[model samples]
Target: MSLTDNKSAGEELLLSRHSVRKYEPGVTIPEAELNEILELAASAPSSWNLQHWRFLVVTEQANKEKLLPIAYNQQQVVDASVVVIVLGDLQANEVAPKVYESATPQIRDMMLGQINGAYSNNPGLARDEAIRNGSLAAMQLMLAARAKGYDTVPMGGYNQAALIQELNIPDRYVPIMMLPIGKAQAPARATERLPLEDQVIRERF
Candidate 1:
């Protein structure tokens, strides 16, 4: 079910989202609309207000075909209008100064100091924050696509090392996941979720 101008933002988009693995071939998403979806996804919150995600949009058919094998021969990778590779910036703290630039000098310096201290002292935490923040943006991206009447398949299965080498991804960024977005060839398969009683914790597990 495609969204319309009259349909307000609600369960229509959120509840309707499902992993769409098949897409109509050759359909194209205009750059302006694509940019809108991406900008909306970027509005997701991040640690220390430093957004840690980057996107690699693969729009050319030749490149998508090249990515197919690396994505385990997923046909959607070839047919989707675009394949967005979500990347996590491992050294996101480097942007703290800019993120807090509007603050007074004294406050900005204090924030920068705390950020540097934590990230520099704990490499593991830094890496965790990268993935954590990226995953948050990834979800928003998928939902944003749905709101735009597009489908998406959020994928984790891929040759990470090969993708990095093929894409020339920087060492400072971690490949988080791939999302193939396009017009669906068929409707997404229905999925069931665990009941709240079964999965939700009232307070603590």
Candidate 2:
């Protein structure tokens, strides 16, 4: 069965997704499909709908080479069809008016006021929110890729300082994670998971 055929295949997609490190070299993801995956990922919720996540898709071999050293020489950086750099905009709150433009004036004003109040004097809180929202988007991106029959791996093993310099990322954007997506070259190995009882908590600690 094709991965995109069923809308109710959430469980199957989640269960099947694994961190793919090896990919079929020279394969490229179609632009239409890549856009579709990104659209799905953008649907993830964010604080005040700020949509703070920023994605930098790198597919060029030369660019991948530039990222290799920053990624600690991870070979997947070069082999994957595309490497999506997920960034969180620290100044996302500044764009409140645009993000809430279609809302009723009262609602928009109220949300903007709340956003300003929440972020203006709190640098730590702002940074936390950026990471939180960006992480949600990143997870959605991975699931979207999996549902489209693509393999993905979310990687945080990289030199953040060097990456910022290499990519020329803006100071207001924090590097959150990197997702490499493509067709897997080998079968994913099985792994163990903790039981729900041990991982979940009910009502209290």
Q: In terms of TM-score, which candidate is strongest?
A: 1
RMSD of each: 3.3, 3.5
Per-model lDDT: 0.93, 0.92
Write candidate 2's Cα lDDT for 25-105 as tens digits: 899899999999999999999998999999999989899888889999998898999999999999898989999899999
lDDT value, residue 82 of candidate 1:
98
Clashes of each: 0, 0
Candidate 2: misplaced stretches above 4 Å? 1-8
The digit string of per-residue lDDT tens for model 1 on 1-205 reads 5434456667667877899988999999999999999999999999998899998999999999999899989899999999999999999999998999899999999999999999989859878999999999999999999999999989999999989998999999999999999999998888887876998788786
RMSD of 2: 3.5
Off by over 4 Å in 1: 1-8
The prediction achieving the highest lDDT against the true structure is 1
